[model samples]
Target: MSPDRANPPETSLTREFLAALTTFGAMGYVVVVNPQILSVTGADRHALIVITALAAIVGSLFMGFIGRLPIALAPAMGTNTVFAMAVAGSGVSYGTALVMVLVGGIVFTLFSASRLREQVVMAFPEAIRTGLQCGLGLFIAKLGLMGGGLLTRDGHFGDLREPSVMLAGAALLATPVLLALRVPAALLLSIVAVTLIGLLVPGAHGDALTHLPAAPVQMPPWPSDYTFAFDFGSFMNHLALALPLAGYFFLGDFFSATATLIGVTRRAGLMNADGKLPNARAAYLADGLASMVGSCIGSPTIAAYVESATGVETGGRTGLTAILVAILFTFAMFFWPLIAAVPAQATTPALVMVGVMMMEGIRHLDCSKLENTVSAVLIMLLTVTTGNLVIGLAAGSFAYTLMALALRIRVAPVLLLTDLLLAVYVALSALTLHH
Candidate 1:
């Protein structure tokens, strides 16, 4: 391609702002859905709404000013579930979970800025990479079902007679149609639509499905409410347990952010002839720093969002597009009351749809490589059956390593180390479970 074809023209300020608006319309659902997902961990929903918005705001600003890319960022879906379900639900406090996230972010930042980033990327095994994404997707979908009360704690179907469960069911069916129609902010709209139904429509109980909140509008929360709120002491006292969780956060953030940045930049024709992203370290650094900031502010990983591709496709070619996105997120922080009022049933649709999308990565698995394919398939099956990300990951890693050795495939030295670490982690976890 010619030079002009390789890079799109610079966008005018008005166009950049419009692109930003479009980008937010595509992903702004996270402003509400994130808190709903994370709130299960016993964190304050109101505080989380503000923190989620703040994470997006800070993340976008970093991408704009430092990375100089149009992509936006926010709390990632998979790692959030890992933090909420696998870590906090397994007896770890939310405060200590945040500390784990912070530590992971720091490590990711250090690696992202050095040659380690390239080396690490090269070390990824295709089967494991594909497996992680698909398995994580299944886990997220499971959470959505249970969180919406559509499923019982034992994974049995809940009473469909409940009005809230019915509404959630309806939302699950409606979200895809909205997405098909290319509706702006389709996920957010689905959430709000279901919430409104739960508010106004009555069922056999002679009442609306969901209870009313104390109010509909309130002042946004201050950063002081969550700044430095993590339990560093707990994390320090439990390094063996905490380190594994931190490793998940680190690996998940690294893969998701790098993949998103590559896809978005390539779509925008910003990749060089060598297929290298310009200012790669800067972009990775911004992503890592945002995750650390997100943890401090009561959120999980904040990384580059794939939804920002809407901005890129809409002719956003400059950092100004991302800056505009930051300003919009800042405005969203004020609607905490309304966002907090959105029930898990309403947001469950988004979780399901996102899970479905994540599962699309399964196609990347090469069936011709039977040994490699087994790893990905096993990961997804184990993850769904066990309802634990760590268990699925550890077992799948060991299985993959064994398969590679048996097939006479050369496994990367890093993967061998990973297998050893996973073995240690599983042993520690078994001890904890028995105790």
Candidate 2:
């Protein structure tokens, strides 16, 4: 047999489909959750859901075709929080807020298209990279544990006997076993198994955990209030108020997408031997473009989703995996209730399992250096505690830079500028995004 023929073709199509299914299972909650968040602006709920799916579809397509990685994209939770609470809650119209998102996307897309964005990402030390990876992983695991019904957000245990908790437990236990046995599509299988369990078993109220919609497939509504609904006039009228908000969206999207891309690609072995990300420009450009397209379609700050790790954990390595994700998003738009039926609890195990797999990056860190250890640990710890990837990276970068300076080590000028900008964003977030 020829040596060239010995290599597998990015795993089988069946595995790619399974990986995409696992990814969708992990992130499907966004279809429901995003609408609720955006509805704070008084947008129509039905419209938001449809737009949310559409945003995912568009972003995933960009990532699949341009970025060409296993990662998927969707409306970001953090930026949406900012858009709803800070931008819209302050009394700007939802349309005005979307205008801000649109402008921000344009700015990010422009910057990402240039090599400067890649340079900024490459300037960071490996410690920061490792921290970003381990941090996002831990945060995901925390999300799983919190949503599994066995634990509160503040670290307390919930009613352990709750039916949801029990079901999550079943999945939590089952996923690891499937993984250990090297089963194909283990995470996807675990999610399906748990969903079936939810359908059959009686809960605390003595009813099935999931109540299926009478009709599984319903045509999605075309958004009347949000699609191409930018209030550019209102945005222009409120330039003083709108400009800063747009700046936040632009800067935040830049950093958050950068962190997610670096973390997920590194996890997928997509980084070059020199430890720099390959196709960083296209990946970032796709991320920025996704946000722009999403904002126009009534979503906010669409970028690469961290939950794409679940697909990577299942042997996905090529863009085909992301294409399948886009395909699933298309189905999700049409079959909203069917998609929604898979509750957060069912997918908690896959997230938890994928998160566990993500922690493997830590072992490869340069533990011999105290600075590296401290910076990486700080990033991982703060990332979870703060529930923000960019914030965690900023904090770790500052720590790393400070240590380097104190030791009289030379730091890149680009990194110094990035740290300064990140520090400003971190300070402002306390009063805005995370507020």
Candidate 3:
């Protein structure tokens, strides 16, 4: 092959920088939103802000330099909510939750380094994977609607008379239009626009867009109370509880990262003939390691952000895009006050839109098949209604396996084993709840 064939022309630095900037804009909302979700576990808000940014910085740097991939990593939205809910429901301290994350990260790292991870990914039939993605999308959208004040606690729509609710409604309507127009950083722009509207309009309840900080700029606070604050005693004392939580975290993180890698790489035309991502090991290792680092810094599981596709779509072809994102995140640490000033109403639209985008996976599923349609619908409904990704996934997997067996369809041994394991896990979880 000619040298030109062997080595593609280098991407323009201008394009790379712009792509990186766009990716950051698309994902930067995480810096504020993660802290908001996780703070419900009684974590210090300022500390969460710092830790969220720090985790993103660490994960993005590792993904860029070590993995040589254009993916950005951050404290994942779904898993962070899971962590907070687990802590609240189990009466566990935030430190104990961090310990669970640590344990999950270790297990994930081991899986990533071995062929086990690959096997697990392959075990899930394509239809099942699509179902999981769709379920998660709806789950995220539910959370967004709740956060935006558009939905009431009783699952009814909030009062349209409320200015905050009106702002959220506007954002919800505008975001899709912006996206449809192929606007760059459309989600981020929607957030800013909604926030600006909130600042200008006083709510019926006297709720302003956000409480402005005394200082527009200030040094980010150190997360001294949270850093390395794992509660080993609690973790060990509640081994049964901790084990399941860790397992759930591991499963969620692994599958989310795997799906993102597959989707992003395929879109970028970076997949090999065997349909495997180039440098897959490096990317997986980086993701797993980032989770561990995030745990140490008092954040939930960190994983590859699907928004990295924005950069790829903008011509990001190398590690440079990721590095730039890391650098931007590092700088973002100094702007904690401004980031924190963003209202939930502003960020909710992005989450909803992202959820909508994730649901696109469902289009690839064979909806004509009864088993496929039922399983997918069940997974989506259970995940949203139950408010637990693990339980939803387990129930769906078990249902799929049983249906396939009844129909005499060939099932992979690995998938069958997964189904059995999940059945046991669900039973144990029920026992725990009963006690």
Candidate 4:
């Protein structure tokens, strides 16, 4: 690829802007979904919406300006779910959870600044990395289907008679057809089409649209309620609880961000000849800083979101795309009502399509090696089944290490150490469950 093709200049600003808009359309669901998930912790729903947007804005801006990457950032799905369901639901105060996030962010920053983060990334074999990408892809698609109500809890097809399901089905079918026709912003267009259909159709609840917001316009208020609300007393009083939760937060953020940066950058042809991402430390710093900012503003730990691939797929090659995403997130704050009116089903197609795109990494794996193939497949299966990326990665890493040792293959010492650490993490998690 030529220099212009690798890093397009401002001459391609229009294309970059459109790519960013496509990314926003694909990922804008986080504006509503984050608050819905975190509100389980006794958080005010309105307050969470503002905080979530603010976090995304800050994180994306950092990625654009400092990291100089096309990656967008947001409060991650799995971490937020764990924060609400495991941390707060387990009787820990919300403020204490924020403290855990803050501490975890600090730890993450330290790790990224040192050799530890690089070592971990280096220890991951090529096959395992490909597996991680494929697993995350499946995970993203599953989330889309589940959130859109296209798939039932038991993994069966949802009732298509339902208006939401029908709309989602239309989106699911329209996305690929549009892409095949080489339509620009096909994902975004499918979302808009389904949203319009949703608005016209009466919903299952006898409403104009069951998932639409009550109002279509509203001014967003600042989330003063949660800003700087960390409870040091609660955090310090429960070292045992805080330590484990903090570890979970740290590992989840670190691994997810690492995987996203690697997968997205490789897909965009940003990796160097040595398979290392250039200026990766800067990206990691941006991710860590985003998490810290999120904790301060009463949101979950923010990280580099894999959905940024949607923009990259659309010819986004530089920080310009991320800057545009940050601007849109800032604007989205004031358009909460309009955003909320677009149901989750409308965004389902984009997520599913992005997942399909990410799955292309599987082709790079050496499937002829049985150990590599088995580990990769296990990673994808466990990720979708357990709904946890950390668990899936850890399980796959351990399996890969053991299989390599049994086959008398030369294994990196770092990988063996990583397997030990993962074993300890799993044991701790099991103990926490029993407690």
> After best superposition, candidate 3 residue 139: deviation in angstroms?
2.1
Worst 10 residues of 4 by lDDT: 2-11
Task: Count clashing residue pairs in model 1.
Answer: 0
Model 3's alpha-carbon lDDT is: 0.82
Find the candidate with the highest TM-score and give its number: 1
Judging by TM-score, tell me the better candidate of 1 and 4: 1
Alpha-carbon TM-score of each model against the true structure: 0.93, 0.69, 0.90, 0.75
Cα distance off (Å), candidate 1, residue 231: 2.5
Residue pairs in clash, model 1: none
Is 2 or 3 the stronger prediction by lDDT?
3
Model 1 CA lDDT for position 36: 73
Q: Clashing residue pairs, candidate 3?
A: none
What lDDT score belongs to each candidate, Candidate 1 first?
A: 0.82, 0.76, 0.82, 0.78
Residue-by-residue lDDT tens digits, candidate 4, 1-435: 533236543427887797798788767767866775676588877788889899999999988887777889999866776677545445678888899899989988888888888666556687777776788678777767876788887999888888878888778888898888867657667766777788777666777663566666578888887899899999987665566557667766887788788888888777766677756888888889889988999988898887788888887877788899999998889877665566677768876876787798788789899889988988889878986555776778888988998999888875675566666757766898899
Tell me the alpha-carbon RMSD of every candidate: 2.6, 6.4, 2.9, 4.9
Give the RMSD in angstroms, all C-alphas superposed, for model 1.
Answer: 2.6
Candidate 3 total steric clashes: 0
